[model samples]
Target: MTARTDGGAAAEPSSGTGRSSSVRRTGRWQGVAAVALLAVAIGVLAKRPPLLLVGAVAGAYTAYPRLTATSDPDLSVRREIDPASPADGERVSVRTTITNEGDAPIADVRIVDGVPAMLSVSDGSPRCATSLLPGGEATISYELRARPGRHVFQPVTALCRDASGSVEVETSIAAASAFECEAAVPDVPLRAPSGHHPGPLVTDEGGEGLEFHSVEEYQRGDPASRIDWRRYARTGELTSMTFRTERLAEVVVCVDARPESYRAADATEPHAVALAADAAGRIGDALFDANHRVGLAGFGRRVCVLPTRGGRDHAGRFHRRLATDPAFGLNPPEPARAAEREGGGAPPRSVTGDGRNGDGADADGTVSIDAQLSRIRAEIGADTQVVLISPLCDDEASRIAQRFESGGTAVTVVSPDVTTAETAGGRLARLERSHRLSGLRNAGVPVVDWTPDQPLGAAMTAIGGRSR
Candidate 1:
């Protein structure tokens, strides 16, 4: 795996030049003035010239802090992560350089590079402390154990102090950097598929297949090998053996990227949406490898639907869309109005059941979850199955799974277990999640209860075993 350093389409840097309005007193010399006054009083009463000299020195020290004023330091930051694209559990090295752009020397410069919350520093430090003269730079180096997802860097935080250390200024520098790790999924965990095109899935319909379906009266153009020769000899009748029909399946991998799905058991770990996206990518790739038509969708702030298709190019498009689409973004979707107010991209248009243009939004322009489900239902065909990836943190996720299954579409749910027992609320949520998964299973929906602690393959194996 190689990391791409080009500031191209993949690297989406944060907006904003830099923010440095904060300035405050450090109070390093808070009591020095009082000490100076005490020394001066003692010198005047005791009538000692050496004491007076000492007092003068103390007074100068007291004034020294006030002599240098603290202002926001002009600085620039450059960051780079090597082995940008890493394999699962690979360690990536990051280096950041903070340069002082101001003419004056900064006596104390402290920098903290913005590391993605999902990644943890495994080696070295993301922090650096040094004095930077004009045009000087300091580097902060660190190693991160890469996880699956598109992890983006936040703004770099810098703190500058004056020579006396009495005043400090803090600022944030924007730098856009990110990397993605794609999980290797050997096969898509799917139940028996019902599809149209000829492929691996066997259907009840008799056609060309390996599995026996039935035997019927022999007709013209019947293949000689298919004839029931033994039965024909015994009964003076000819019959042709028919086998089950095999067909390729179209699968839509839907990711639950709603705000509710962003929950994580640990703050430092990747959220459920990220995990879902990662799993969805792997599932899509596996389906494509099997010659099955694959599509992508996101039930986020707006309904996103990429109609089912097949090809090597389509696979690449699917992976790129999962990584870059706002619906599957690492951050929760901003409210539609808020996004408009902030001049961000407008919310995507709601899609109809036919995957065409439709207004599924309310007056506030927020697409309802029901509308999103309706759109997905429209995409489902007789031979198409839906693989729903969600955290299952709430009843809505269960509702989605049940809805798809009730519609007569083969549905398999891959739920990332993000619930923890660290708190009372977390414990309750965990219980609720357990109940929800159980309910889904009872409802005849295949549920893969996936915990981040185990590899996705293990969870798929559990699902595969249950599917049998």
Candidate 2:
């Protein structure tokens, strides 16, 4: 943001505080010198004592005029910034103005504008030093580097001091301005063929794709390349060939933001749950823009699902919700000792009601893990593609994925591996991690091992390749 000063000329001080202070100090010192000189003159000239006293008094009075010198200046400051939404690593210009608001003439004025922490000044400082009389103003300008996310403007500090620096007043003015630097996401073409699916579902509506659908009698609007020469030669009827519709796919991005997924392997912005949310947002946008139906779902203690929809509006809604979602680790299973490792054995038949195993059943004879998966599978249609986003640290998650895949659902695992040494230990821990991953992959589930250090688009590209 830039700064500037406005107005011109100095104004007289209504209050004499500045003049009074100067007079008081100068008069006292002059009075002392006069008394000493009067005594010396009386000694030197007993006959000229009257004349010496008059000279001493005259000298003291001369100091009074000097005390009357004072300057009362009125000063104000303003700042401005341009192109608030700058891309990361780009430069933005800042402008400022300083104005004389009071009657007194400010000998020296210094103004400083506060900059958000994310941005760094690239050229010149936000601070400006100058002199301004009442009604006089000055303008200052500079530049800064912008970073990603929202950045707020800080208050501007102004220091007004006299030429002698004996008297000074500090004032701060509020500036309600900010700049946003947004990061860029890679735009990859969506490959799904069904235009009905949410997102940028690519279609054969005059776009790139490979599929033949029908042929119609050629009209004036028909493209030359679409003219079916074989039909024209056989029956002497000109025809235009139409291709099959090829659009983006419908993708349901399910994020496990339950308290269980918040654990992180390292300190990073958007911990485990947040990372998953961000990745989901980026992938959802790409798919939606490619003309696919995209839906958002968050599962934890409670499940929040945004019905599948296609369009830019839906994409924005998903992002806003994800940004504000709660941040907490998933709840541990009740009766910690009863926590069953995923894929170790079938969960108790009572909890799941599948009659698969007896050991892991809950008190009510319910298979807790599989039951949840069953509900999820029921909610989504058999043909719909499900992308499960989570930091799969336990066996239940693996089992859930396995069940979904086994139930004829195409499952793509976006695993935000958040476990660190502090949570998992030794060879046993490593083996368990490997086992759970293997179980899902073996079930024909495409897995994306996403970490916090990499961009989420990278993971999606890898998954897209596998899907193709």
Candidate 3:
């Protein structure tokens, strides 16, 4: 059978090709009545026993369907998904078994298992048409490609019909399983720091390296090669040469998964929330490679936070959180208060605590800006530099940047410009977004206004080439 992807469960099923041939009130009873009456009249007038019998049969056939029509169908369905939480672009198999619990035999049975709207079925079909007797069962299996996000399977739609095709029972039942794709955390390339910490990054600082930084009085345990032999010979004093320091910094990749930030000029294109995730992962990977301790945080369904740490294991933990975590895998923003009124909506709230500050986030993902800032200030370390990925539509990013700078922590605003100036409203929105970026720069926070047309690495490189 050809597998199909439905946009989602429909309020009414007759809208698509999976249409049912429901019973119609076309007055077929009138035709049956006319035939029965004609036969009865002929039998009485002509005194024919054959005509009388024919009339009786006609009457019984017409009434039998209505009498046997089933108003209530007794049935149960159980669904299962293998590898319920699959990675992005992975395929998953779904199976559903429906059992007939009624006493009578159902001649025609049609079932449609609710599928995730974001997934596309690659093999088999969720729908099946079959007949089942009392205690009999039927099963359906299908395969679907997994997308990045949490998906809630809808209820099952079942239609049962009697043998005469005259009676049918239609009802929906809850499914046994749900599918989810967690946040896919990735590595990101972050700026290096100067410290005597164990890391792969080679920076311009006085520590251990080949490049000379400065010379100081020789200390114990100094390698002979590090000693400035010419200076020692000339001055008859032991002196050591300091080289660049290879160190790691506490880097946090902050993603603005806010519903308002997830938009695009074209509906067909992926939203900015998705882009931010991609950048976060790749950048985190690069930073980790350089031995930088990478962390992750975001504002979506809730505040998601991971502390700064460095290791291969830590990288895997970050990816798992980004891919499967509800805070990162939520759907795009709906047309709600969260999108329209973001300042009062969810801000940069930390995820570790009670969603603290008493400004609880709404179910749709909006939090108070002050509460978010307070949470950030408390949750993150003082030495950590925040790499913020957002659309910069609201003043939230600017405010956060200002606060971080005031606290002596460097902040970079990498905004994915998703606005189009094709219309008056579009032009106005673009102007406002640019203004927000300008304000951040004025506040000493370097901003990278990135457009979606180019790769994220290029935009980041542009920001990196400048002195901070």
TM-score of 2: 0.46
Residues 104-135 of candidate 2 have per-residue lDDT tens digits of 67777766665553345788777778888777
Candidate 3 stretches greater than 4 Å from native: 1-189, 192-196, 214-224, 230-240, 336-367, 466-468
Q: What is the lDDT of residue 444 in candidate 1?
A: 85
* Model 2: CA > 4 A from native: 1-181, 186-208, 211-245, 267-270, 324-376, 421-431, 466-468
**Candidate 2: lDDT over CA atoms?**
0.57
Error of 2 at 362 (Å): 21
Q: Which residue ranges in model 1 land beyond 4 Å of their true spot?
A: 1-87, 104-133, 136-138, 148-182, 202-206, 211-222, 228-244, 333-363, 379-382, 465-468
Q: Which candidate number maximizes TM-score?
A: 1
User: 1-468 in candidate 1: lDDT tens per residue?
Assistant: 011122433344534453433576768786877888888888899987787888788889888987887655888766777887988789988888777777888999877777775676789977778999888989898998886666777667677789898887766666667888776663566666566678865666787899888999899999999999999989989999999877787889999987778787764566788788878877787788888888898986666788788999999889888876666766544453254335422222111111212345523676788987898778756767889999998999898888888888888899989999999999999999999999999988888888876677778887675221
Against the true structure, whose lDDT is highest?
1
Model 2, position 58: C-alpha lDDT score: 64
